[model samples]
Target: MFLRKSFTAALALPALASPALAELPHDWQLGMQPAATPVMVQIEDFHRLLLYIIIGICLFVLALLIWVMVRYNHRANPVPSRTHHNTLLEVAWTLIPVIILVLIAIPSFRLLYFEAAIPKPDVTVEAIGKQWFWTYAFPKDGNFQFDSYMLQDAAAAKAHEPRLLGVDNPLYVPVNKVVEVDTTGADVIHSWSVPAFGVKMDAVPGRINHTWFKATRLGTYYGQCSQLCGANHAYMPIEVKVVTQAEYDAWLAKAKKKYAANETPDALRVAAQ
Candidate 1:
C-alpha cells in the first residue's frame, strides 16, 4: 500500500510541479537537448554557432526586403538611379557567399571527420537492425547477443517510463569508454540516431558502417530510427544505459554466464530464471 501510494505521488508531482511546462522524462528540455556525451557537447556548440549565423542572415534578409519595398517604391522615388548593375556590388555579392561557404565548410568537414574517425576503442559492439527491432552483440566482451524490443504500453505504464521510447533491453556501456559500433541490416535499410551522442549512421544490408562515441556521463539516453524503413519503423527505439566501470564489468560477467549454454542445469536454470 505504501509503495502504491509512493508511485502515485511521484506521478502526481510531475503534473503539479509545472502545470504550464511540457514535462520531459529526462533532465534535458525540448528547446535544449542533452549534452551528456562529449561528442554531443561538440555537436551542441556547432548547432548554436549555426543557429546564430542563420538568425543573423534571416534578419539581414528581412531588413533588406523591407528596405527595397519601402525605399524603392514608385511613390518614394519616382526617378530611379540610372544603373543596371554595379560591378562592386556584383563582386561583393558573389565573393561574400563564397566566403560564407568557406566559413561553414571548415566546421562541417571537421564534424564529419570527427564522426567518421574511429579512435582506439575501449569496447566494440556490432548492432544489427532487424524488422521493428534491434539486436546487439558485445563482440569484445563475450559475443553475448540480445534483441531489444519496445516495451508494451502496459509495461511502460507500470514502470512509469516514457511511452513509445522505452525498450525491454537497453544497451549498456561504461561511461568514459570509447565504444566502437558497427552497424548492419538483416532486411531493409535503417538508421540509428541518437542526438545526444551525435551519432547517426545508416544500417545498410550486406555492409557495415562504423561509428564511435565516448559517453561522459552516466544516464539513460533515448533515441530512435531517423530513417523510415518500414511500417513499424516508429516502434523501434534505442535506449543506452551508461554505468560505472565496475558496474559494467559486473554486468558483462553476469551477461556472459547468463547466455552461456555449457553450465550446470541448476546454474543454467538459475541464470535463466
Candidate 2:
C-alpha cells in the first residue's frame, strides 16, 4: 500500500521538470512511453499496425452480425432457406486469416532479428539485481559499480529526482551510441526493463543475459523491475540518463572516483572483453 501511493506520486515528478526535458511517464497516459531508441520506434510502428488491423476486424464482424440480424429475422424471411454451408465463404475466411497472419509474421521476424543483432557497442553496462535494489557496473568505462536505491519522496524532491523512479546513482550512457547491458541476479530472478528503450532482459542467478539499446535522445528515462521477484519488487526501479559524449566523459571521471571498483581486475577485464 505504501509503495502504491508512492508510485502514484512518482507520476507527477515529470511535471516538476521542463516538459521538453523529461521523458518520464505522465498521469493518465493512454499510450506507451515515448520512443527514445531505434527498437522502440519499430515497436511503436508494429503496435500501430496491429491496432488498425484489430479495429478493421471488429468493424467487419459487427457489420456481418448486423446484416445477419436484418436478413434472417423471422419477419424478414418467413421461409428459411435450407443451406448447410458455403464452401467459398469457408475458404475465404480461412484464406483471409492466413494472409493476415503472414503479414504480421513477416515484420515480427524482422524486428526480432533487428533487436537480436546488436550493433558494435560503444559501451557496456552490467546490471545486477539484488533483493530490492539494482547495482550497475560500467565494465568498459572504469570497472566501477554502484548500488541504486529508490529515493525517498523528500530527498527526491530536493534532488530533482522523480519520486519513486529516482535513484541515488543513475546509470549513465552516451546518447546516440549503442549500449550493451548485461543482466544477472544475486538472489532471485528479476528483469531489467526500460520501456522507452524497448530493452528488457531477465537477470537470472548464475547466468548473464544481454540486451542492447541505442538512445537517440538525451534525457532521463525511468523503468522498474518487470519480473516479480519478492515483496520489494515494486521498489527496485531503473534510472538511465543519456547525455552527450562530453557530459558522459565528465560523469565517467567523477563516478570512477566516487564509486570504488567492486569487481576484481581480472573479472573487469573479462567483462570488458
Candidate 3:
C-alpha cells in the first residue's frame, strides 16, 4: 500500500548531524528503545529483573500443575481422598505468595521513589497538554514557548520524518543535563511521556506534576501522550532533541527571538506555526 511505502521510505532516510534529529523506532521493535538516560537504564535493569522472576514463577507453577495431574488425576488415583485437610500445603501457598509480593514490592518502591525525587534541575520545561497537541515552555531559557503539532502524513513523507511522530517543533534540552518537566493539562488529563528517557508524568487539571530525565546521549527521542485525552489523542506526539550545551544556548537565543517571551500564548502559538 502507499502508506507502507511511505513508512519504508521514512525509515530508510539517513540521520542528520544535529542530535536534535536522531534515531527513531523501527518496525516490530520487540524491546525498549535504546536507553538515552541513566533513569531509563535503571528501568531496563528493573524490567529484566522482574522478567526473570516472572519466568521462574511461571515455570514453578507449571511444574506444580504437572505434578498434581500426574500424582492425583482420576486415571492415576481412582480413589479420591475423602479428607482434604492439608494445613501445611495451605500455609506453604500463602507464605510463598507473600514472599513473592515482598520481592516485587521492594524494588517497586525503590524505583517509585527514585522517579519521584526530582533532583536539582539544570533546566525546567513546562509541558501543557491540550486536546491534541503539546505546548512546551522553557522557563530557564528566557521563558520562550511553542506549540508542537504533529506533521501531516504528506509533509512527513516529503521530509522523510516518521508519520504521526514528527512534530512542527521539538522540546530541546542539553545533553547530560537534568531536565525537569512540569506537566499540566489545558483541557483533559494527559500524560507527557518519553520511553527512552523513562519519564512519564500525568498532566492533570489545575495540578502540576513533575518528572526529570538527563539525556546521556545527544539525540532526538520521540513519545506520545500516554493518556487518552480527546478524539485526536493519537495525533499528540512528543519529540525531544538532546543537544550539547552550546547548541542549546544557540537554539535558545534564536527561540527567544522567534517565540517571544512577552507574547501571549495565542500569539506565540500562531507565530511558531
Candidate 4:
C-alpha cells in the first residue's frame, strides 16, 4: 500500500506545481527580473542591446590585439613599425566609441524618464523605514497603517520558507494598478527595492522619495534593503502582496477597522466602534 501511494504522489508531482511555483524570486542568475510590465520589458530590451554592443567592442579589440601580436612579432617582422600615429586608426577608434555611447545613451535616457516621470498613480502608499523594520501607511485608504517585521527562523521553518527574507506584514497592492510609493526614514537611510517590479528608492530622514510600478501578475514578491544602514540591515526585508482589486478592497476595509481604533484615543470613537 505504501509503495502504491508513493507512486501515485510521484505521478501527481507535475500537476501540483502551479505557475506561481515555477516563477521564483528574481536573482543574479537570471540577470534581471523577468519582464512582466511594459516598462520592465523595455528596460530588459535596452539592457540586452547594451550588452551586445559591449561584447562586440570587446571582441573586436581582442581580435586586433591578437592580430598585432602574431603579425608584428620579433620573429615575423625583425623591425618594429616606427610610425608615430595612424590617423585613420585613431579616428576610427574615437568615432566608434562616440557612436557606441550614442547608442547606449538613447535607451538609457528613455528608461530614466520612464522611471522618474510620475504617471497617474492608481494608489499611493507611504513607506517609512525604522531601525530594523518598516512601517507602511495608506493615506488614501482610510489612513491605514501597519508595521512589518522579518520572520524569525523558527517561524520560517514551520512555514517551510527562508527566514529574514520573509516578513510578518506585506504591502498589499492591486495587480495591474499603478502604485506610487513615497519612502522616508525615521532614523537612518534605507532603500526600498523590489527586483520583480524594478523599483528602488532611497528613504532619507525628513525627506520623501517617490517611485512607482504597476504589477502585471498577482503574487507575493520579496525584496531587501539595498543600502547598508544599520546593524540589522539584513533583517529588514520588503514583501509586497499583489492581489485583485476586490481582494485589496476587502483587506483594506478590515485593516482600517483594526488600526483606526488604535490610531485615535477618542473614547467616543472607540466606544462607537
Candidate 5:
C-alpha cells in the first residue's frame, strides 16, 4: 500500500509543476533562466552556439601552449629555432577567425532581425519609467494605467511575492500572444526589460522604443531596471503575468474599470498606494 501511494504521488507531481512559476536567481545559479518565450529559446540557442565555439578555441589554445612548453623548453632543445614569421600559419590563423566570424554572424543577424521585427501584436502596453517605479498603461484596453512599486520585506512576504522582484501591479498579457511593450522615460533614462521573455529596450526621454514577446507558458516573470538612473534605481522592478486567454480578457475588463484614466495623477498614486 505504501508503494502504491508513492507511485500515485509520483504521477501527480508533473501536474503540480505547471503552477510552480519560475523565480529569479537563487543561490549559486550559473545558468540562464528557463525560457518562457520563443525569443528566449532562440537567445539560449545562440548562447549555446557561442559557448561551444569558445570552448573549442580555449581547448585549442591550451593544447598549443602545452605543446610549446613540452617541445621548446631548454631541457628538451638547447637551441631555439629563430622563426619570426610563418606565412602559412599566419594566413591559416587569420582565415580561421574570419570563417568563425562569418559562422557567428549568420545566426546573430537572424536573431537580431527576429527581435526587431514586431509582429501584429495582440496587445500593447506602454511602460513609462519614473524615478523609482514603473507606470504602465494599457492603451489598447481603454488607456487604463497604474503605477507599480516594489514591495518591501514585510509587504512582499504578506503578498506572497518574490523579494525585490514583486511589484504592487504587474503587467498582464495572454499566453501565446504577441505583447508589444512601448517604453518611454518619464524623467531620466531607464530600461524596460524582462529576461525570461528576452525583451529589453531603453526608455529614453522624449522618445518611444519598443520590444515584443510572446509568452509560450502561463506564469509570472520578473526583471528590474537594467540602467543606473538614480538613488532608488534598485527599487524599480518589472513583473509580468502571462495567463490564459479567458483569464486575460477577464482581467483586462476588470482593470479597465478599476484603473480609469480620468483620475488625477495624485489620485492614481493614492489608489496604487
Candidate 6:
C-alpha cells in the first residue's frame, strides 16, 4: 500500500506543477527560460545553432594543436619543416570561416526580420520608466494607466510574491495574441526587457521605442532594466501576466474604471512642476 501511494504521488507531481502561473528564474537554472513566445523559440534556435558552430570550431582547433604537437614536436621531428606556407591550407582556413559566417548570417537576418516586423496587435501597452518603478498605459484600451512599484519584503511575503520582482500592478495581455509595448524614459535612459518574450528595447528620454510579443503560455514573466539607468536600477522590475482573452477583457474593464481617473503618477506631476 505504501509503495502504491508513493507511485501515485510521483505521478501527481507534474500535474501540480503545470498550473503554476509563475515562471521566474529558478536555482541552478540552465540556458534560457523556457520559451513562452514564438520569437523566443526563434531566439533559442539561433542560440543552439551558434553553440553548435562554436563547439565544432573549438574541437577542430584542439585536434589540430594535438596533431602538431604529436607529429612535429622536437623529439618527433627533431627539425621543423622548411616549407614557408601552403596556399591550399591557407585558402581552406580562410574560405571555411567565410562559409561558416555566411551560414550564420542567413538565420540571423531571418530572426532580425521576425523581431522587427510587428503584427496587428490586439493590445498595446506603453511603459514609462521612472527612477525605480514602471508606469504602464493602455492607450488603445480607454487610455487607462497605473504605476507599478516593487513590493517590499514584508509586502511580498504577505502577497506570496517573489522578492525584488513583485509589482503592485502587472501588465496584462491575452495569450496567443500579439501585444506591442512602447517604452520611454521620463527621466534618464532606461530599458524594458522581458526574456520570455525575447523583447528588449531601450527607453530613451523624448523618444519612444517599441517591441512586440505574442505569448504562447499563460503565466507571469519578469525582467529588469538591462541598461544602467540610475541608483535604483536593479529595483526596476517589469512584470507581465499572460491570460486568456476573457480574463484580459475583464481586467481591461476593471482597469479602465480604476486608473482612468488619475493616470499620471504624483511623482511625475511633481517633476513637471
| Model 3 lDDT per residue over 193-250, tens place | 9989998899987777888999998878899999999899999999998999999989
lDDT string for model 5 (73-154, tens) is 9999999899899999999999999999999999999999999999999998878899989988776567678899999989
Return the TM-score for candidate 3, rounded to 2 decimals.
Answer: 0.86
Error of 5 at 187 (Å): 0.3
lDDT for predicted candidate 5 compared with the true structure: 0.86
TM-score-based ranking: 6, 5, 2, 4, 3, 1
lDDT of 2 by residue, 1-273 (tens): 999998977876665555445677889999999899999999999999999999999999999999999999999999999999999999999999999999999999999999999888899888989999998987667777889999989998888777888888889899999999988888999999999999999999777888999999998989999999999999889999999999999998998888864652354346435
Candidate number achieving the greatest lDDT relative to the actual structure: 2
Please give the RMSD to the true structure for each candidate, in Å: 7.3, 7.4, 7.0, 5.5, 4.5, 4.0
Clashes of 2: 0
The positional error of residue 226 in candidate 5, measured at the CA in angstroms, is: 0.4
TM-score of each: 0.84, 0.90, 0.86, 0.87, 0.90, 0.90
Q: On a 0 to 100 scale, what is the lDDT of residue 61 in model 3? A: 90
lDDT of 1 by residue, 111-151 (tens): 87887789999988777788999877765577567888999
Ranking by lDDT: 2, 6, 5, 3, 4, 1
lDDT (C-alpha) at residue 245 in model 5: 96
Select the stronger candidate by TM-score from 1 and 6: 6
Please write out the lDDT profile of model 4 over residues 36-136, one tens digit for every residue. Answer: 55677777888789889879878998999999999999999998778999999999889988988997898899899998997998998888888999888
Model 2 residue pairs with clashes: none
TM-score of 1: 0.84
Output the TM-score of candidate 5: 0.90
